[model samples]
Target: MPSDVSRSSARPGGSATDLAAVWAVFTDMYEAYLAGDRARIDAHLDPEATVWDSATPQLLLGKPALDQVRAQRPAAERAGGGPVEAGLTAYDQVIDVFGELAVCRHWLRIDYRDRPSGLLRNTAVLRRAHGGWLITHLHEDGQAAD
Candidate 1:
């Protein structure tokens, strides 16, 4: 978990731990994103998953497409010379589990080091595999900050 991010109470399957586990997958991904660690992010993604990223112009069909975007990051960002991400906050989190599948929805606010903060509404679908969770689908849309 990122020490800069605060975790909110989870709502899922009547088990806080289940939500905790699911939350970990995302927190881990967020940490990887901040570090520009593509491999770590890939580990949590399902091979056939889809992503509708907040800044992308079109839907990203799978891990390959996601990787392509990661590869296009600015050298300044990859080298840690850009504005830092002060922290991330999630609000109105909701998670529901059905058998081995789970769905999560939350609104995220990212506080940047020297830029205007950004907000995104996100949703994710996850499946249980190898005793862990993998994201099968993710959608993020930029939102106006309040």
Candidate 2:
């Protein structure tokens, strides 16, 4: 279980509402990814967002890189096929906001029905725009799941 469900910020200018919304952006994006909802996932991503995923070899930037990764999903998945079911959970979340920018760091555990679960050490940088938040950058490294 994650402690980020509740927000109590000690940093100046970082409010509970901001913390919750920032955390929500992380969860919301993963939920969309698991559900194969590309539109929803893109909704949370900044137009110029960059991501270094747990399995990727190089940093991915902008729309072209994003599209190429989507096209290369087959290479990343199982030889037979993809996961039949999967559940994503997070813990040890630290969310902070400074004006229009926020940083969210968390341990993400992804449980697959038959495949080995993946643990992600992730940091997401988000920018608040038009009353909402979009992921500006994401850095992630894979770890052995216990």
Candidate 3:
């Protein structure tokens, strides 16, 4: 996490603190993606993590599947003749923490290749394990591009 980012007032075991931590993790994950640092992204994902993205019909299950997709990212980015610029901005975020589990819901605007790709509503479930927060499941619904 960036040292400059403001810390939430919520305590470690409290929902607010957990929510802030989740947001920090989310930010770090995307920053890693933008930098093409798959290892960093992988570090934040649980072994049995799953994801459903708007671009694919099949569900992504486990690290292997996720890694396969990430492996292709470089080739895909080459289409843009360099690193693809990507970012995720979240809104209407709601977070709930239950012990070591946390669920976050938010509306997101994702930009890819320097332009807005889509608006998505997402729910991500994370668990605190291996001494840090790791994403366990993610479900995303595609919305009309804005």
Candidate 2 overall lDDT versus native = 0.81
lDDT for each residue of candidate 1 in 33-87, tens digit (9 for 90 to 100) = 7676878988999998999988688789998898788668787876787778988
Residues 83-129, candidate 3: write the lDDT tens digits: 34566666666667778888777677777775557788888899988
How far off is residue 92 in model 1, in Å? 2.6
Q: Among these predicted structures, which one has the highest lDDT? A: 2
Determine which window of 10 residues in candidate 2 has minimal summed lDDT: 1-10
Each candidate: RMSD: 3.1, 2.6, 4.2
- In angstroms, give how far residue 59 of model 2 lies from its true place: 1.2
**The CA-based lDDT of model 1 is what?**
0.80
What is candidate 2's lDDT per residue for 112-146, written digit by digit as tens? 88888889899989999989999999999898988
What's the true lDDT of residue 139 in model 1? Answer: 95
Residue 12 of candidate 2: its Cα lDDT? Answer: 56
For model 3, state the Cα shift of residue 34 in Å: 1.3
- Model 2, TM vs. native: 0.87
Best by TM-score: 2
Backbone clashes, candidate 3: 0
Clashes of 1: 0
Candidate 2 off by > 4 Å: 1-4, 7-13, 75-80
